[model samples]
Target chain A: MLVLELMVVIFLASIVAGVIGSLVGLGGGVVVIPILTIGLGVDIHYAIGASIVSVIATSSGAAATYVKDKMTNLRVGMFLELATTTGAIIGALIAAYVSSIALELVFGVILLLSLIPLVRKIGEDIPVTPELVGLSKKLELTGSYVETDGSTVNYNATRPAQGLAGMLVAGLISGLLGIGSGTFKVLSMDLAMKLPMKVSTTTSNFMIGVTAAASAGIYFVRGDVDPIIVAPVALGILFGASLGAKALPRAKNPTVRKIFAIVLAIAGAEMVLRALGI
Target chain B: MSLGNPDSMNNVISKVLRYGVLLSAAVIVLGAALLAARDAFSPSASLLHYDPNQIPHGPFPVTFSSLTAGLATGSPDAIIELGVLLLLATPVSRVLFSVFLFAAEHNRAYVYITATVLTLLLFSMLVTPYIPVFGG
Candidate 1:
């Protein structure tokens, strides 16, 4: 009975995380970690392990739909993955040597920092810039995505170097912290590479699975992933993400973004407090 | 040279992603049900607290022979682990599919790039375990 109860609670929390994560273009880890740790009293390592699995679940679930819709920029995502995968390996190696407290502190800071982009872009559609940098032009890293209203939006990605650099850092943080690091990836595409918000978001979604997979192997090897714990979390998130994907086209963007910003703020403070041993 | 129709490639990839997630989720659900049933017979301690030090370290030995043996025994843990393996394989398969798509399009630059990513992914999954320091 207790086992069933635990599974139900964790499963429900994961579903909520997945819904919020898919709607806001964040992976479910941010919410999963807090819920597992603070709400359920799970150890941080176990929470992270399960959360990483949830990230892959949400990423794969959403990416499937985004790819079919032609919202994902495969070219850009593929190109940047080289750096991200390499950085993931390095970060995983570093994680083996670092202390948990230090990791928590870093995770807290990243969570807080991720909110800036969400808050800054609130209530406004980011305009597409016309110019592409030399590298972007050489790679032909531009694409068109159809909006909800059936209008096509074409966008060019500028500053390939900056985007790649940002992805490396994002990957590093993702592997170390066991989160999707989607916020950083979107910031790179939207702010640095000048991709449209929709493009940045979907492409980031597509990229996260591969990034998380890069480090998941390490976690698996380290025995951090418990199948019993991950099974429910992964399955729950998969269902929730699929539902969120269906609703995304009809949902109001500004409202969702505002809700996500508030959630992030609370999650960020909780992480900092936990890290401070409070 | 122009790559094969990017649209067709995207469709194939999307199908792979969708089916992969669905299949893995189904398997995990079955495994969870089995796990719950098994736990009912012999209840273990709470799942919430696990000591990192007490758990056996190193990559799970998921070779073909072991998986077959475990499946024959109907081990719930093995089934759950297999689902996890499939979940991980979804993205890895995506990378592999991209390699083929890039090659079919005769896009040499992307083929090489995608191949490199595939190699890195394989190395992490297959090679990382042997490198003692990574607990392989």
Candidate 2:
């Protein structure tokens, strides 16, 4: 129970969290929260603080590679940020009025519902190219990335209005719960926007940093971001996320989709349990 | 990926993010190392047992003056906080830089869009603390 021993244990646990989080675009908070609160017996506030920092770490660490490899759709990410950031601010303002229990139940249901497409797409490696909407063409929300086979797969984002709306809700929940809500972001891109799984995961990874940063300052000011906790969590997540990032480019889309579905299932179940006060 | 094109913007921003994370990690490692060295001489209990009033709990409140003062004395906590501060700042700086990237592309529409995002970010981080509803 010495301070040195605590740091080493937490640092080791965070590496596993980082790997799974970056692989599925969950930002690793899901893994970090339980490890800190349940395993380390850290206060929930401090755990949240550490998780938020890990979210940023996972985003930046994984994104550094995704962006350079052109897997992240930069234009799509920036365009969507307009909605997510606005939604986040609004969610924060209205959080005082909203019942967190109801919100959790609703989020849980939505996440479970999002699993349908992933389940259906289990057999497909890449998403079939969809007809581009006029708005997509006008916005130029299209890009291409090279697959493991060295062939470039071109893709376009459809249903911009709906996609943006989903991002708004994602941001709202993120601010409301003080969680990254990366599941919703990936769902928006993968389902509503009809983007490829690789792009959705990487783009979600790319954007979560900004989304989490919006609330991270508040946590820091509140003194919840203990340096002893955050330091190991951040470093461990960065290392793990870098490993995940390297593997993702060569990872199959269907495999990534399956991993996302499994993680979503776990997160959704946890939300339901928390809402029920279990 | 033509120069000044939106595609090229990714390359620039990627490098920024990479270096930002690396720099913060370096600072954090230094602080953790310092903490380990300090603890080796005068051992403390696990973080869970630290006094709630101390940095291990919810009382490491950060401010510009306090941060600078602590850094001047080589406080491990402040150094780690600075690293966290840098980590938080990376995405904000990326957004700010994106505005310039958009402007360079001569894409007025995106410039406005990116700028709006940046404004919202700043508002949430810097302005909301004044609003009592947010528990600031």
Candidate 3:
């Protein structure tokens, strides 16, 4: 009976994850883990494994279409992947020696601090940069994406420094926490780099799997990945993410963001509590 | 063309990529679920047995033991679990990072959100060490 309830929780978490992830252009795996730990009483070790597996699943699922449509900048993804993959391996190596308690404390703090940007809307305009002037023209990074407005947006990458800073954050977190940090990645491209959000997100999605695989390999070799814990969460999340992805069009923006905010706030508090052993 | 441009080639590319990713996420989720269920409910449960010996018997027992030692220790070892957990925390961090970017664009609150979920995961894992499931 408890198992069944847990399954339901996982499903709900996935739906929530998908809705929020789609709007923000980050995948739902991060949201799902915290929910499972705080709400459903899942272990972080298992939770991480499950979440990583789901990352592969969801990325693969999404990448197929993104690649087919050519919205994903394979070149850009590949370029950035170098940073993320390196960071992930470094993170994995560090995790193996760190105390789980400290890990939780740090992770919770990062999560709490990471939310500052989501509440505000940054530059919604197209950006133009001298560095990017020849960039979009040369690499085909300049492209269009369809919007709900029924308009096509031709966008370019702007503010290479800003975008790189976001990537640096992603790399650190990937190494430190093992996430794609795609939200930051996409946000950087959209706001700082002045690329289309759609393009940024799609490309970020394409890159997450490679980033994760790097660290996951370390976990696999280290025996941190327990199949028992990984299987259910992974499978449950995948199911929910797909359903949520489908529900994306049907969901509202503010409503979803509010839900995302509230959930994270609670989860953030929970992380602090757990780390304190409360 | 801008990101919001109506007829740019990037617009079409974005839509294709979005849809394509959605489809792939679905299949990966469903297939993994089936496999997980099978593993969870298999009649030959004993075959899925785990023992202390299993840890040391592997091709690289030293690596496994070191992981356990790292986890048992307290400062740096915590990093290994960070990557997988990040995937789980990706959604929440998205908002925080978004706030950051937008703040610089027009200037705003900047929340820097993430953690609630990771705390929970760590809490759960810590407890895993105390509990017995498969007849430990």
Candidate 4:
């Protein structure tokens, strides 16, 4: 294929990934990586590099809207980021030494694991008594956000250490797979930290950019990043994510979750097959 | 004063993030256009080719000096790199901004937490290169 054709194809695919990702609150990397590697026949390393860039793009684009809406809990996000960033650095370094096939297998397994949350429909908004732990209280990691119906839902975080540990694992997967690991982050916040669903999702989105950025530099330094490939993917995801963010409020969560789960399952199976040299 | 107010602080950070994304995307589009134009004019001298196995790998070192030099010479690749750099920098800046915001609010615990996050981020970005085991 000609250079122009290739760019156009990647750009369009990235747009779809970004749109689906934003609507589902998963970010673009999951769709972007599978499409690039399985559909386009791109190398896993290069695909990961491009996916990471798209992750940053989508996160930054959507985060702007989330922050402004006050849906993001900055205090909670910032506190958890310490673990994520550190885990990202470690994961990226480990990735450098790991073989491509091994990385592909790991990615597939994580993709499959990500399905658990979707199946269980965890992280939904249910009124629960806030369990304020010592660390959460000390850090004052509590927040409230106005819902779509204009009702303010206030909440407090608990089990700070558990959330931090979960974030570390989430960050590790994100760096290793070049995806946002949004499911894991949300799980940590919603389950462990006891944050409201809105705050957990938005704050997780807010932290993803920083987590990806930490690992991206390492990827760039290792020469995995290609400017030519990244240009279209980044631009496409950014544009698509912005549109998806606009559409998110009106989109039905159950429908989006089902679609996202199906996509992830197929992508995971394909990745495993590829890893097994199929 | 703005930093002391959570609402204003969030507004400022949001604007920064939005503008940062827009600026980076615009720069990347410009660079992509330049690349396409260059290829169109000289078909034999293609700047991009899609070979998954033989794609360009790890030759270009990204540093401030090289980026500046490439931009000065109007190198399309460098321009694209700059755009990526700006995208990565946006999140880092947000963390930094949070540090100041927390400090202004006299939230000492959060100020410490944010600062720690920022420090870890910088360590990964800058200090990791010197560590031989990480192969940075």
- Best of the candidates, DockQ: 4
lDDT tens digits by residue: candidate 1, B1-136: 2339878878988988998998898888888888778767764464323433444322333455665677678877678778888998999999999999988988888898899988877876667656766545
Alpha-carbon local distance difference test for all models: 0.78, 0.86, 0.48, 0.78
Of the true interface contacts, each candidate retains a share of 0.59, 0.64, 0.06, 0.75
**Candidate achieving higher TM-score, 1 or 2:** 2
Best-fitting candidate, measured by lDDT? 2
Name model 2 segments beyond 4 Å from true.
B43-59
Q: What is the lDDT of residue A130 in candidate 4?
A: 79
The TM-score measured for candidate 4 stands at 0.89
Better of 3 and 4 by TM-score: 4
lDDT (Cα, tens digit) per residue for candidate 2, span B74-136: 988899999999999999989998898888888888888889989999998877756789867
What's candidate 4's i-RMS value?
Answer: 2.1
Better of 1 and 3 by TM-score: 1
lDDT tens per residue, model 2, A26-65:
7888888877777777787888889889999999999989
**Which lDDT tens digits does candidate 4 get at residues A30-137?**
778767777878787788888778878888888888788887888888889989988988776786677857876876787788688657874344447576668887
Question: What are the TM-scores, per candidate, against the unseen true structure?
Answer: 0.89, 0.95, 0.58, 0.89
Docking class of 1: acceptable
Look at candidate 2 and give me any clashing residue pairs.
none
Interface RMSD in Å per candidate, to 1 decimal? 3.6, 2.3, 13.2, 2.1
Q: Relative to the unseen true structure, what is the C-alpha lDDT of residue A142 in candidate 3, on a scale of 0 to 100? A: 54
User: What does candidate 3's lDDT look like per residue over A1-278, in tens digits?
Assistant: 23334455565566556545544445566676767566556666556655655565455445544544555665455445445544554454455466656765775676566567645643233334334455444443455545455555565665555565666666556545655556556655655665544566667766665555444543454354543344344444445444544543333434445544555555556557777988
Residue A180 of model 1, lDDT score: 78
